[model samples]
Target: MKLYHHPLSGHSHRVHLFLSLVGVQHELVEVDLVNGSHKKPEFLALNRFGQVPVLADGGTIISDSNAILVYVAKKLKLTDWLPESPAGAAEVQKWLSVAAGQIAYGPAAARLNTVFNASFRADEVIARAHDILAVIEGVLAERTFITGSTPTIADVALYSYVARAPEGNVDLQGYTKVRAWLKRIEALSGFVEFRKTPVGIAD
Candidate 1:
Protein backbone atom coordinates (compact mmCIF):
# COMPACT_ATOMS: atom_id res chain seq x y z
CA MET A 1 0.00 0.00 0.00
CA LYS A 2 1.13 3.54 -0.71
CA LEU A 3 -0.14 6.50 1.28
CA TYR A 4 0.00 9.86 -0.49
CA HIS A 5 0.25 12.69 1.99
CA HIS A 6 1.93 15.85 3.22
CA PRO A 7 3.88 15.53 6.45
CA LEU A 8 2.36 18.64 7.94
CA SER A 9 -1.28 17.92 7.18
CA GLY A 10 -3.44 17.06 10.21
CA HIS A 11 -5.60 14.97 7.92
CA SER A 12 -2.56 13.03 6.87
CA HIS A 13 -1.33 12.70 10.43
CA ARG A 14 -4.58 11.02 11.40
CA VAL A 15 -3.99 8.30 8.84
CA HIS A 16 -0.38 7.94 9.89
CA LEU A 17 -1.40 7.48 13.51
CA PHE A 18 -3.82 4.73 12.55
CA LEU A 19 -1.27 2.94 10.42
CA SER A 20 1.14 2.97 13.32
CA LEU A 21 -1.46 1.77 15.83
CA VAL A 22 -2.65 -1.03 13.61
CA GLY A 23 0.90 -2.17 12.81
CA VAL A 24 0.19 -1.65 9.15
CA GLN A 25 3.11 -1.21 6.83
CA HIS A 26 2.93 1.08 3.82
CA GLU A 27 5.07 3.45 1.79
CA LEU A 28 4.68 7.20 2.13
CA VAL A 29 4.61 9.30 -1.02
CA GLU A 30 4.72 12.95 -0.11
CA VAL A 31 2.24 15.21 -1.84
CA ASP A 32 3.73 18.62 -2.51
CA LEU A 33 0.80 20.78 -1.53
CA VAL A 34 2.87 23.95 -1.60
CA ASN A 35 3.58 23.44 -5.29
CA GLY A 36 0.04 22.19 -6.05
CA SER A 37 1.35 18.81 -7.17
CA HIS A 38 -1.82 17.20 -5.90
CA LYS A 39 -3.69 18.79 -8.80
CA LYS A 40 -1.72 16.86 -11.40
CA PRO A 41 -3.13 13.89 -13.30
CA GLU A 42 -1.26 11.22 -11.37
CA PHE A 43 -2.71 12.39 -8.07
CA LEU A 44 -6.13 13.30 -9.48
CA ALA A 45 -6.52 9.72 -10.56
CA LEU A 46 -6.05 8.67 -6.94
CA ASN A 47 -8.27 11.42 -5.64
CA ARG A 48 -10.53 13.39 -7.87
CA PHE A 49 -10.55 16.25 -5.35
CA GLY A 50 -6.76 16.29 -5.44
CA GLN A 51 -6.47 15.88 -1.72
CA VAL A 52 -3.75 14.38 0.41
CA PRO A 53 -4.30 11.26 2.58
CA VAL A 54 -5.05 9.21 -0.53
CA LEU A 55 -4.28 5.53 -0.22
CA ALA A 56 -3.67 2.81 -2.80
CA ASP A 57 -4.55 -0.65 -1.51
CA GLY A 58 -3.45 -3.10 -4.16
CA GLY A 59 -5.14 -1.52 -7.19
CA THR A 60 -7.81 0.26 -5.14
CA ILE A 61 -7.61 3.98 -4.43
CA ILE A 62 -9.13 5.68 -1.37
CA SER A 63 -9.40 9.36 -0.47
CA ASP A 64 -10.66 11.60 2.29
CA SER A 65 -9.08 10.97 5.67
CA ASN A 66 -12.19 9.49 7.26
CA ALA A 67 -12.91 7.26 4.29
CA ILE A 68 -9.32 6.10 4.42
CA LEU A 69 -9.78 5.35 8.11
CA VAL A 70 -12.84 3.22 7.41
CA TYR A 71 -11.17 1.41 4.54
CA VAL A 72 -8.07 0.61 6.58
CA ALA A 73 -10.01 -0.39 9.67
CA LYS A 74 -12.23 -2.71 7.65
CA LYS A 75 -9.37 -4.16 5.67
CA LEU A 76 -7.35 -4.99 8.76
CA LYS A 77 -10.28 -6.64 10.52
CA LEU A 78 -9.59 -4.44 13.48
CA THR A 79 -12.97 -4.19 15.07
CA ASP A 80 -11.67 -1.74 17.68
CA TRP A 81 -10.68 0.63 14.94
CA LEU A 82 -14.21 0.73 13.59
CA PRO A 83 -16.15 -1.77 15.73
CA GLU A 84 -19.11 -3.95 14.66
CA SER A 85 -22.83 -3.91 15.47
CA PRO A 86 -25.03 -1.11 14.18
CA ALA A 87 -24.83 1.21 17.19
CA GLY A 88 -21.09 0.82 17.62
CA ALA A 89 -20.42 1.51 13.96
CA ALA A 90 -22.67 4.56 14.03
CA GLU A 91 -20.80 5.85 17.06
CA VAL A 92 -17.55 5.44 15.16
CA GLN A 93 -19.08 7.28 12.23
CA LYS A 94 -20.04 10.11 14.58
CA TRP A 95 -16.43 10.78 15.54
CA LEU A 96 -15.33 10.43 11.92
CA SER A 97 -17.98 13.03 11.09
CA VAL A 98 -16.51 15.38 13.67
CA ALA A 99 -13.09 14.80 12.19
CA ALA A 100 -14.00 15.46 8.55
CA GLY A 101 -16.72 18.02 9.13
CA GLN A 102 -15.97 20.12 12.21
CA ILE A 103 -12.22 19.64 12.46
CA ALA A 104 -11.74 20.66 8.83
CA TYR A 105 -13.73 23.88 9.03
CA GLY A 106 -12.89 24.77 12.59
CA PRO A 107 -9.50 24.28 14.23
CA ALA A 108 -7.59 22.97 11.23
CA ALA A 109 -8.70 25.55 8.69
CA ALA A 110 -8.59 28.33 11.28
CA ARG A 111 -4.97 27.46 11.94
CA LEU A 112 -4.25 27.63 8.23
CA ASN A 113 -5.95 31.01 7.95
CA THR A 114 -4.74 32.78 11.11
CA VAL A 115 -1.23 31.36 11.07
CA PHE A 116 -0.46 31.04 7.36
CA ASN A 117 -2.74 33.82 6.11
CA ALA A 118 -4.45 31.51 3.70
CA SER A 119 -7.57 32.88 2.04
CA PHE A 120 -10.71 31.64 3.72
CA ARG A 121 -14.19 32.80 4.62
CA ALA A 122 -12.72 34.25 7.78
CA ASP A 123 -15.39 35.47 10.15
CA GLU A 124 -18.09 33.05 9.08
CA VAL A 125 -15.79 30.04 9.02
CA ILE A 126 -14.11 30.69 12.35
CA ALA A 127 -17.32 31.42 14.18
CA ARG A 128 -18.56 28.01 13.16
CA ALA A 129 -15.21 26.51 14.05
CA HIS A 130 -15.41 27.79 17.60
CA ASP A 131 -18.91 26.39 17.83
CA ILE A 132 -17.57 22.99 16.84
CA LEU A 133 -14.85 23.13 19.48
CA ALA A 134 -17.43 23.86 22.13
CA VAL A 135 -19.32 20.71 21.25
CA ILE A 136 -16.13 18.69 21.11
CA GLU A 137 -15.22 19.78 24.63
CA GLY A 138 -18.46 18.34 25.91
CA VAL A 139 -17.71 15.04 24.20
CA LEU A 140 -14.16 14.98 25.55
CA ALA A 141 -15.26 15.55 29.13
CA GLU A 142 -17.12 12.26 29.18
CA ARG A 143 -14.33 10.03 27.89
CA THR A 144 -10.61 9.68 27.56
CA PHE A 145 -10.97 8.92 23.87
CA ILE A 146 -13.44 10.64 21.57
CA THR A 147 -15.93 7.78 21.08
CA GLY A 148 -15.00 5.00 23.44
CA SER A 149 -12.97 3.55 26.30
CA THR A 150 -10.22 2.60 23.89
CA PRO A 151 -8.68 4.83 21.28
CA THR A 152 -9.99 4.28 17.78
CA ILE A 153 -9.94 5.99 14.39
CA ALA A 154 -12.20 8.68 15.86
CA ASP A 155 -9.57 9.72 18.36
CA VAL A 156 -6.88 9.65 15.71
CA ALA A 157 -8.97 11.85 13.43
CA LEU A 158 -9.68 14.48 16.11
CA TYR A 159 -6.38 14.61 18.00
CA SER A 160 -4.02 16.39 15.62
CA TYR A 161 -6.16 19.36 14.69
CA VAL A 162 -7.24 20.08 18.26
CA ALA A 163 -3.79 19.49 19.66
CA ARG A 164 -2.42 22.20 17.39
CA ALA A 165 -5.25 24.64 17.95
CA PRO A 166 -3.27 27.34 19.71
CA GLU A 167 -1.03 27.80 16.71
CA GLY A 168 -4.08 29.30 14.98
CA ASN A 169 -4.69 31.59 17.96
CA VAL A 170 -7.70 29.50 18.72
CA ASP A 171 -7.22 29.36 22.45
CA LEU A 172 -7.64 25.84 23.82
CA GLN A 173 -7.04 27.14 27.31
CA GLY A 174 -10.60 26.65 28.46
CA TYR A 175 -10.99 23.13 27.18
CA THR A 176 -9.22 21.42 30.06
CA LYS A 177 -10.77 18.02 29.56
CA VAL A 178 -10.01 18.07 25.89
CA ARG A 179 -6.47 19.13 26.62
CA ALA A 180 -6.07 16.22 29.01
CA TRP A 181 -7.37 13.86 26.37
CA LEU A 182 -4.74 15.24 24.02
CA LYS A 183 -2.03 14.32 26.47
CA ARG A 184 -3.51 10.88 26.88
CA ILE A 185 -3.41 10.24 23.16
CA GLU A 186 0.18 11.39 23.03
CA ALA A 187 1.17 8.95 25.76
CA LEU A 188 0.02 5.86 23.92
CA SER A 189 2.53 3.15 22.98
CA GLY A 190 3.65 3.29 19.34
CA PHE A 191 2.14 6.76 19.23
CA VAL A 192 4.02 9.10 16.98
CA GLU A 193 4.00 12.82 17.58
CA PHE A 194 2.07 15.32 15.53
CA ARG A 195 4.16 18.40 14.93
CA LYS A 196 2.90 21.88 15.42
CA THR A 197 2.45 23.36 11.98
CA PRO A 198 5.39 25.67 11.39
CA VAL A 199 4.96 28.93 13.29
CA GLY A 200 4.78 32.04 11.17
CA ILE A 201 3.50 35.59 11.05
CA ALA A 202 -0.25 35.95 10.78
CA ASP A 203 -0.70 37.61 7.46
Candidate 2:
Protein backbone atom coordinates (compact mmCIF):
# COMPACT_ATOMS: atom_id res chain seq x y z
CA MET A 1 0.00 0.00 0.00
CA LYS A 2 1.22 3.47 -0.85
CA LEU A 3 -0.23 6.47 0.91
CA TYR A 4 0.23 9.75 -0.98
CA HIS A 5 0.05 12.46 1.63
CA HIS A 6 1.28 15.83 2.86
CA PRO A 7 2.55 16.11 6.42
CA LEU A 8 0.55 19.22 7.31
CA SER A 9 -2.72 17.85 6.02
CA GLY A 10 -4.97 16.55 8.77
CA HIS A 11 -6.98 14.52 6.25
CA SER A 12 -3.80 12.72 5.23
CA HIS A 13 -2.73 12.22 8.82
CA ARG A 14 -6.09 10.62 9.63
CA VAL A 15 -5.48 7.83 7.13
CA HIS A 16 -1.82 7.48 8.14
CA LEU A 17 -2.75 7.10 11.80
CA PHE A 18 -5.34 4.41 11.04
CA LEU A 19 -2.90 2.45 8.87
CA SER A 20 -0.40 2.48 11.73
CA LEU A 21 -3.03 1.55 14.33
CA VAL A 22 -3.93 -1.45 12.18
CA GLY A 23 -0.22 -2.35 11.92
CA VAL A 24 -0.19 -2.28 8.13
CA GLN A 25 3.14 -2.33 6.33
CA HIS A 26 2.94 0.45 3.76
CA GLU A 27 5.02 3.01 1.93
CA LEU A 28 4.55 6.72 2.48
CA VAL A 29 4.67 8.71 -0.74
CA GLU A 30 5.03 12.31 0.35
CA VAL A 31 3.28 14.34 -2.30
CA ASP A 32 4.89 17.69 -3.04
CA LEU A 33 1.73 19.61 -2.24
CA VAL A 34 3.57 22.93 -2.10
CA ASN A 35 4.98 22.50 -5.58
CA GLY A 36 1.64 21.74 -7.30
CA SER A 37 2.46 18.04 -7.65
CA HIS A 38 -1.01 17.02 -6.60
CA LYS A 39 -2.48 19.22 -9.32
CA LYS A 40 -0.47 17.62 -12.07
CA PRO A 41 -2.23 15.40 -14.59
CA GLU A 42 -0.46 12.29 -13.33
CA PHE A 43 -1.60 12.93 -9.79
CA LEU A 44 -5.13 13.95 -10.84
CA ALA A 45 -5.44 10.52 -12.45
CA LEU A 46 -5.47 9.01 -8.96
CA ASN A 47 -8.07 11.43 -7.62
CA ARG A 48 -9.81 14.00 -9.79
CA PHE A 49 -10.29 16.02 -6.67
CA GLY A 50 -6.47 16.24 -6.52
CA GLN A 51 -6.38 15.63 -2.80
CA VAL A 52 -3.67 14.20 -0.62
CA PRO A 53 -4.12 10.90 1.27
CA VAL A 54 -4.98 8.78 -1.74
CA LEU A 55 -4.39 5.10 -1.04
CA ALA A 56 -2.97 2.92 -3.75
CA ASP A 57 -3.41 -0.74 -2.87
CA GLY A 58 -2.33 -2.92 -5.79
CA GLY A 59 -4.46 -1.88 -8.77
CA THR A 60 -7.13 -0.39 -6.49
CA ILE A 61 -7.05 3.35 -5.85
CA ILE A 62 -9.02 4.81 -2.96
CA SER A 63 -9.49 8.54 -2.40
CA ASP A 64 -11.00 10.57 0.41
CA SER A 65 -9.75 10.07 3.96
CA ASN A 66 -12.93 8.60 5.42
CA ALA A 67 -13.34 6.33 2.39
CA ILE A 68 -9.78 5.13 2.82
CA LEU A 69 -10.44 4.35 6.46
CA VAL A 70 -13.49 2.29 5.50
CA TYR A 71 -11.59 0.44 2.78
CA VAL A 72 -8.66 -0.44 5.05
CA ALA A 73 -10.88 -1.51 7.95
CA LYS A 74 -13.02 -3.70 5.71
CA LYS A 75 -10.10 -5.15 3.78
CA LEU A 76 -8.28 -6.07 6.97
CA LYS A 77 -11.46 -7.58 8.50
CA LEU A 78 -10.85 -5.45 11.55
CA THR A 79 -14.37 -5.68 12.88
CA ASP A 80 -13.29 -4.14 16.15
CA TRP A 81 -12.26 -0.97 14.32
CA LEU A 82 -15.40 -1.09 12.22
CA PRO A 83 -18.43 -2.86 13.61
CA GLU A 84 -20.44 -5.37 11.54
CA SER A 85 -23.91 -4.85 13.06
CA PRO A 86 -26.31 -2.40 11.46
CA ALA A 87 -26.66 -0.22 14.54
CA GLY A 88 -22.94 -0.26 15.16
CA ALA A 89 -22.20 0.62 11.55
CA ALA A 90 -24.73 3.44 11.64
CA GLU A 91 -23.25 4.79 14.85
CA VAL A 92 -19.77 4.81 13.30
CA GLN A 93 -21.06 6.40 10.11
CA LYS A 94 -22.65 9.22 12.07
CA TRP A 95 -19.32 10.30 13.52
CA LEU A 96 -17.63 9.87 10.15
CA SER A 97 -20.20 12.30 8.79
CA VAL A 98 -19.29 14.73 11.55
CA ALA A 99 -15.60 14.30 10.68
CA ALA A 100 -16.35 15.14 7.04
CA GLY A 101 -18.74 17.97 7.81
CA GLN A 102 -18.31 19.75 11.11
CA ILE A 103 -14.72 18.70 11.73
CA ALA A 104 -13.75 19.81 8.23
CA TYR A 105 -15.36 23.22 8.26
CA GLY A 106 -14.43 23.78 11.87
CA PRO A 107 -10.96 22.82 13.09
CA ALA A 108 -9.48 21.68 9.79
CA ALA A 109 -10.52 24.78 7.93
CA ALA A 110 -9.17 27.02 10.66
CA ARG A 111 -5.86 25.20 10.64
CA LEU A 112 -5.61 25.59 6.88
CA ASN A 113 -6.23 29.28 7.30
CA THR A 114 -3.28 29.60 9.63
CA VAL A 115 -0.75 27.04 8.46
CA PHE A 116 -1.29 27.20 4.72
CA ASN A 117 -2.54 30.78 4.54
CA ALA A 118 -5.82 29.60 3.06
CA SER A 119 -8.47 32.25 3.13
CA PHE A 120 -10.99 31.57 5.90
CA ARG A 121 -12.56 33.75 8.52
CA ALA A 122 -10.63 32.80 11.65
CA ASP A 123 -13.27 33.93 14.13
CA GLU A 124 -16.01 32.06 12.33
CA VAL A 125 -14.07 28.82 11.92
CA ILE A 126 -12.67 28.96 15.44
CA ALA A 127 -16.20 29.40 16.82
CA ARG A 128 -17.39 26.52 14.69
CA ALA A 129 -14.54 24.45 16.07
CA HIS A 130 -15.62 25.19 19.62
CA ASP A 131 -19.26 24.36 18.91
CA ILE A 132 -18.37 20.92 17.58
CA LEU A 133 -15.79 20.38 20.33
CA ALA A 134 -18.41 21.13 22.97
CA VAL A 135 -20.75 18.55 21.49
CA ILE A 136 -17.87 16.04 21.40
CA GLU A 137 -16.97 16.90 24.97
CA GLY A 138 -20.53 16.15 26.04
CA VAL A 139 -20.57 12.87 24.12
CA LEU A 140 -17.16 11.85 25.49
CA ALA A 141 -18.22 12.69 29.04
CA GLU A 142 -20.76 9.87 28.87
CA ARG A 143 -18.54 7.29 27.18
CA THR A 144 -14.92 6.30 26.68
CA PHE A 145 -14.84 6.77 22.94
CA ILE A 146 -17.07 8.03 20.17
CA THR A 147 -20.03 5.67 19.44
CA GLY A 148 -19.18 3.47 22.48
CA SER A 149 -16.51 2.20 24.86
CA THR A 150 -14.20 0.80 22.20
CA PRO A 151 -12.51 2.97 19.62
CA THR A 152 -13.66 2.68 16.02
CA ILE A 153 -13.03 4.15 12.58
CA ALA A 154 -15.16 6.98 13.94
CA ASP A 155 -12.49 7.79 16.50
CA VAL A 156 -9.74 7.56 13.91
CA ALA A 157 -11.68 9.90 11.64
CA LEU A 158 -11.98 12.50 14.37
CA TYR A 159 -8.56 12.18 16.00
CA SER A 160 -6.10 14.12 13.84
CA TYR A 161 -7.90 17.42 13.45
CA VAL A 162 -9.31 17.41 16.96
CA ALA A 163 -5.95 16.62 18.51
CA ARG A 164 -4.44 19.48 16.54
CA ALA A 165 -7.36 21.84 17.04
CA PRO A 166 -5.19 24.21 18.98
CA GLU A 167 -3.28 25.06 15.79
CA GLY A 168 -6.52 26.54 14.51
CA ASN A 169 -6.90 28.72 17.57
CA VAL A 170 -9.61 26.33 18.73
CA ASP A 171 -8.62 25.97 22.34
CA LEU A 172 -8.96 22.53 23.93
CA GLN A 173 -8.45 23.78 27.47
CA GLY A 174 -12.17 24.09 28.18
CA TYR A 175 -13.07 20.62 26.92
CA THR A 176 -11.67 18.41 29.65
CA LYS A 177 -13.30 15.21 28.48
CA VAL A 178 -12.32 15.78 24.89
CA ARG A 179 -8.74 16.31 26.01
CA ALA A 180 -8.86 13.05 27.96
CA TRP A 181 -10.34 11.31 24.95
CA LEU A 182 -7.41 12.49 22.82
CA LYS A 183 -5.01 11.11 25.40
CA ARG A 184 -6.81 7.75 25.37
CA ILE A 185 -6.45 7.49 21.60
CA GLU A 186 -2.77 8.38 21.93
CA ALA A 187 -2.18 5.49 24.30
CA LEU A 188 -3.48 2.94 21.80
CA SER A 189 -0.85 0.54 20.45
CA GLY A 190 0.67 1.28 17.05
CA PHE A 191 -0.51 4.88 17.36
CA VAL A 192 1.33 7.47 15.28
CA GLU A 193 1.62 11.16 15.99
CA PHE A 194 0.15 13.80 13.74
CA ARG A 195 2.83 16.35 12.79
CA LYS A 196 2.01 19.60 14.57
CA THR A 197 1.91 23.02 12.96
CA PRO A 198 3.12 25.80 15.23
CA VAL A 199 0.40 28.31 14.60
CA GLY A 200 -2.51 30.04 16.33
CA ILE A 201 -3.08 28.70 19.85
CA ALA A 202 -0.54 25.95 19.38
CA ASP A 203 2.14 28.65 18.97
Point out the worst 10-residue segment of candidate 1 by lDDT: 194-203
Residues 52-160 of candidate 1: C-alpha lDDT, one tens digit per residue: 8898899899998888989998988889878898998998888788777878888788778866688877666667667887887888778778786898888888988
Kindly state the number of residue pairs that clash in model 1: 0
lDDT of 2 by residue, 1-203 (tens): 99999988899999999999989999999999989999999999999999988999999999999999999999999999999999999999999999999999999998989899989999899899999999999999899999899999999999999998888888899899998999999999999999976688842
Reference-based lDDT, each prediction = 0.82, 0.94
Counting clashing residue pairs in each candidate, in order, gives 0, 0
Q: Return the TM-score for each candidate structure.
A: 0.91, 0.98
> What are the RMSDs of all candidates, in order?
2.4, 0.9
User: Which numbered prediction scores highest in TM-score against the true structure?
Assistant: 2
| lDDT over C-alpha atoms for residue 189 of model 2 | 98
TM-score, candidate 1, is 0.91
Model 2 residue 61 lDDT score: 99
